[model samples]
Target: MDDVKPKVVVDPSAGFCTGVKRAIATTEKVLEGDGEVFCLGELVHNEAELERLNHLGMKILDKNHLSRTTIGSHVLVRAHGEPPETYKVLEDKSVKITDATCPVVLRLQQKVKKASEEMQASGGSVIIFGKASHAEVIGLLGNTKGKAYAINKKEQLDSIDFSKPIRVFSQTTSDQNEYEDICNQIRIKSSNLSNGNPDIEINNTICGQVSRRGPALEIFARSHDVVIFVSGSESSNGKYLAGLCKSANPLTYTVTGTGQINPEWVLNAKSVGVSGATSTPEWLMLKVAAEIEAMI
Candidate 1:
């Protein structure tokens, strides 16, 4: 009698989102071309993908390195975007830049800039519901001239001065439910502070692609006996989505690549689901699934 192999399924919805794909394609095209292409940040969150790009002649640089190096011909902005100051500095240095900022993020920046202008004269403030140091949030803050406040968690809402007008926005990859709750709480807080005359403006800035993945991944996770969520350790979206999978199914495990897959995790499983973050590559997930298949 032959031993049975556990069925493996890869999540169709997993892999790069539109913004990340756009950035990677832009970087690849630049890399194929001329002298040197420097990416301001890790082009994408996946270490494997970054390593591949590095081999193809893409140089990763931070602001300090970019500022000091005056010889580069092109600096590629990742999908997360950069502050206005980053652009100004690059411009002053006469460095040509290939901006791969996501369309969604660009639009959010514009909205935040406009809202900041609207509230500036009134002593009002702009607040963001996102990780304070996230690249996107940092870029968003640039639109507000460093006047915006970032709320990493719900408890941080108390820091806002409700006496003044407020404009709120969210990072594109932030959880929709959490963002909504933040908005609702802001509204409630504002009303109580302003005698129900709150001058609050709220913008739904979360990306549709990212928001949809949460529920989709949850459903996919529950359908399988065990789940392998692949993503780079540095990817914030990966961490969030992996947590969602674990919530849906306790047997879920996270790995950066096929190399990180644990044989024990897949043993005795009847079905396995392989999924990844938006920064994760489709091929990587396929590889993970293949590895799991081989195990059984």
Candidate 2:
């Protein structure tokens, strides 16, 4: 039994991405001095990280909170940027805004805004390859003044008049492979609609960090006998990356934290690799590794 105990290895590359790191650091800096800072939404998708931040006196709020914000209160616009109207409400209520939007997301918002303006003038359409309900997608559409179409599923393509000109952009954290597939489908349909001369512009708007992380995680997944994927359950990309790990190593299992790990999953495994989503905190991953060590 001692010889068979699995050696737990936490992936060094698995942890918060640069943008999430920046957001967490910014929030921590504010919380340390300000006490009870208001965040517009969950700072990051990882629930464990959110819990840690919440314990540190971060108050998470929704859009409705914007309307009722007390005058001169400090409000944090999370990494998932908000609509212009959100800023307007905060300003009207005299809330001090600390913008912590990711730089990649901010640039995508600007590009989508400009594209929508151009499309509006020429009777074209701006299409977003992302979840319609995602906070970032909502912000992207707001930049277009509610003029852009968000296509999360291929079936939603029916809503678009592809016969007209089109521009495509993706949420910064969207699955890169999925984005490409959606773009290809859109392009093919547009060509069929417009007699092979589809007028379309697709922007490489997905975060380079997300785009590069997939391949790296795939390699990491393949290198391990068993993979424990840690991430907030609500994270969209977490599911995708975890799926990548599952694909590479069928013994992969996902958990929000150490307590969720199943001892049965690591049975007969000689080497267990632990990895996490971009929003996952490094300390959480380390704790998970320790838990795995205890289990084995």
Candidate 3:
């Protein structure tokens, strides 16, 4: 008997988001120029795309590495958006800076900074709902002069003192539901104290580009028999999208690259779908699709 091949359907929103799009466009434009351009971090989370850019003479610079590099060179900020002081450091070094910070993240940073200033002026504290060590989280903390408390989970809410007025904001890519849960907990905590006054101000600063993926992934997942989620392991949104796919279709598999695809996963499936996070590249997804087709 002959084996049947699986059909592959790619998600419409599988690749780069608006922020990543802007960053890539800026990088490509810079590549057209004659200078040695360095990105503060990976322009996007996809390693394959980064390698491709690397071949084009784009260099990835870590924070420590950046400090050691010669001054007056060109440096492009990634979509994650760096703290204001980062730009100051580059300026002091006479580095020509190309800022590709996502407009949404830039706005979020401004909002957080403004809120923090207000809180500080009123003698209150600022709480940030996000991963502690994430680049975006660090950027958010920078707005508050490193005085913000970063909370990743609901349990972290316990550390906030309800006795004091609180101002809160979320990382641009944080889980929306988790942000809501944190806000609810904070509200409850605030209500319980200070004679039932809800003094906590929670700002929903999560980017719509990232948050919209959840529902879109759910819809896309149901249309296929097996789903392949392609994204970098370091991307939180990538992990979330994979979970959404798995929850929608038990046959879903998350792979960093096409090489990780197991032939057995699609073994009896007719329609196999492919999707990825905002940080993923369209070429990478196409590669994964090609790999799936080749297996079939």
Candidate 4:
């Protein structure tokens, strides 16, 4: 008797959000030039993709390399926009810059900057609901001249002074459901602190594409018996989405690429789903699907 092979389905919605694709496409165009170009940060969170760029002669310029930068040298900003100071530093060096900031993030930064200015004059607070150390948050803080407060979770809101007027903004990639919950709690806290006069402003700043992904991904995760979530270790978006898959399917497993797929994952499954993060390349997902096909 012939052995049965599990059917594998790759999530059509997975891989390369609009912002990341724009950033990478910009980088690739620069790479085509023979002259050197420096990327300020990991262009994307995937190690395999990074390695591919490196092989193509991409140079990454960390802070240590800043001083070595010469005038007229080209530098690229990834989708994760940097703080204003980064631009100032590059400008001071007279370096040419290709800013590939996501248009959505650019708008968010502008909004945060304006809100920061307003809050500074009002003696209120500008609250950013995001990881404090994330590059995007760091950039947002720069807009506020380092005066804005960043909160990773709702519990951190205790540190905020709700008596004053408050403006809340969320990172583009943060979980939408969690951000809603945090805003609700903020409203409750502000009402109690201000005698039911909650002087609070909540802006839904999360990118629409990312906000919509969770629901779609959850559905994809449950449609098959086994789900393989592909993403680099460094991507927070990947981590969040992979967790969503795991919640929907107990057989979910995470890997950065096809190399990490295990034969056991497909040995017992009648159907498998391949999914990935916003930073993941579509080609990688297809490869993972092909590898699983070979195994089962």
Candidate 5:
């Protein structure tokens, strides 16, 4: 039995990406000071990290709560960049805004805002290929002044008026291939409507960090007999990475933490690989690997 114990390996590529690392580091640094630190949203999608931050006296606030924010209170924006309007409102209130927006997201927002401004003059519209209510998408929509159309599924393309000039931008963390497909569909539809050339501008705004994960995780998953994927339920990256792992290895199982790990899943596995989303903490993944070792 000792000789037959499954060999477990944690994926080297798994854990928080550069943006998440920056956000977490900024939060820790802010918490070190003797002041009220309010994060605009969950700094990271991982519940354990949130718990740790909460224990450190970091307060998480939503949009509604943010509206009621008192003047002079310190607010930390997460990696998902907010709209210019949010900054304007916060500035108007004299709130100390510590922006921790990811550079990639910041660039995307700038591009979207600029494109939307250009299109606004021409009676064109901005369309976002992403989850409608996602935090990042919400921020992206803010650049369009509430006029951007968010299409999460291919079927939603029908809602777009192809006759008008269109500019498409994707959420920084959205699936790259899916975004390209959506843009292609829009281009085809617009072309048919115009009988030749379509006035469509496509912006590939997906973060390179997110764009590379699908293929990297696929290889990691295929290298093992069974893959243990860790991520929070509400994390978009978590769901996307887990799906990639599942597609690569049928024996893949997703768990938010160690407690969710099923012994049965590890029983007969010869080799086990552990991986997580961009928002997942390395410490959490280490703990998960230790739990799997204990089970074996």
Candidate 6:
């Protein structure tokens, strides 16, 4: 029998982003301590990573679940960040807080808040390009006193009154191309309205980390016969990355862990590639690669 060897190509962008790295590092540090450590939310989007950390004694707590837990416990904030009110509620319960919000997101939140305040002062509306229900979107909206409007598609731009001045921004992990498309549509619509005002101000607030992943994943996907895209099912960016790969190569498969891999996907393929989202860990990808190698 001929020795079957599978070539594995890993995406350059397939590791933890700065925010997720920081959150994981903090969680590891807390786990080393003597106290009972609790995470305000999932430390990262990857289920495998969460499960590994949970094994180390890190407790994941949700809003309702947190309500049932004892007060004055140590709570670590995840990368997605929380609204100021969440902190206040925690404080009321005397919970000690350790924040691990992604620095990029932290900066974006500050910029959104500051820009919103400036817009409110100048009688302009704050418009965000993002999923309305996302926790990050909620945090951004909270900065605007609930006055901010979210636009997920080009059609949402029509709801805006062009007569009024507008300031636009997006969630850090949003699709960059979509963000630009919406901005262009808004500008074109505002131009035709003849509201007797200046040009609509559009701010490209999408993070460079998220924006750079598209091309990277595209290039990596093209070099392999079969591509495996790993990410937590809950991660929007992970799904987007997988979609990019699928568009580039029809043989792309999305999985949350190594156990999801089917040997049949690589039966006739020699060069198999693996990639993951910013929230995914490098160790997980290596494990998946090892699993594929064993199958060969």
Q: What C-alpha RMSD separates each model from the true structure?
A: 1.6, 1.4, 1.7, 1.6, 1.6, 1.9
- lDDT of candidate 3 over 248-272, digit per residue (tens): 9888888888789999998678889
Pairs with backbone N, CA or C atoms under 3 Å apart (clashes), candidate 5? none
Q: Is candidate 1 or candidate 6 better by TM-score?
A: 1
Q: Which consecutive 10 residues in model 4 have the weakest lDDT in total?
A: 190-199
Candidate 2 error regions (>4 Å) = 1-5
In model 3, what lDDT does residue 209 have?
A: 84
Q: Which ten residues in a row have the lowest lDDT in candidate 6?
A: 193-202
Model 3: pairs clashing at backbone N, Cα or C within 3 Å: none
Structure candidate 4, residue pairs in collision: none
Clash count, one per candidate: 0, 0, 0, 0, 0, 0
lDDT (Cα, tens digit) per residue for candidate 4, span 1-296: 65666689989898799999899888888878854689987888998888888888778889557888888888998898999989999999998899999999999999999999999999999999998889889889998999998987778889888889999999998877788999999989988863764678999998887768889999999899999999999887888788888999989999999788879977889899999999999888999899999888
Model 2: how far residue 129 lies from native, Å: 0.7
- How high is the CA lDDT of each candidate model? 0.88, 0.88, 0.85, 0.88, 0.86, 0.82
Q: What is the lDDT of candidate 1?
A: 0.88
List the lowest-lDDT window of 10 residues for candidate 3.
Answer: 1-10
Q: What is the lDDT of residue 124 in candidate 3?
A: 73
Deviation (Å) of 190 in candidate 1: 1.3
Candidates ranked, most accurate by lDDT first: 4, 1, 2, 5, 3, 6
Residue lDDT tens for model 1, 1-296: 64777799999999899999999899888888864688987889899899888988899998777666575578889999999999988988888789999998999999999888888888888998898888999999988998888997778888778888999898988877788888888888888863774688898888888778988999999999999999999887787788899999999999999777778888889999999999999988998899888888
- Write candidate 2's Cα lDDT for 1-296 as tens digits: 26756688888778888889889899999988888789998999988888889999998888865666788788999999998999888888888889999888898899999999999998999999888899999999999999999998888998888888899998988887889999989988887863764579998888877767788888888888899999899888788889888988898999999788888887668898999989988899999999888887
Q: For model 5, where is the 10-residue window of minimal lDDT?
A: 190-199
Alpha-carbon lDDT of model 4: 0.88
lDDT of 4 at 135: 84
Clash pairs detected, candidate 1 = none
lDDT winner between candidates 5 and 6: 5
Better structure of 1 and 2 per TM-score:
2
Q: Give the TM-score of candidate 3.
A: 0.95
TM-score of 1: 0.95
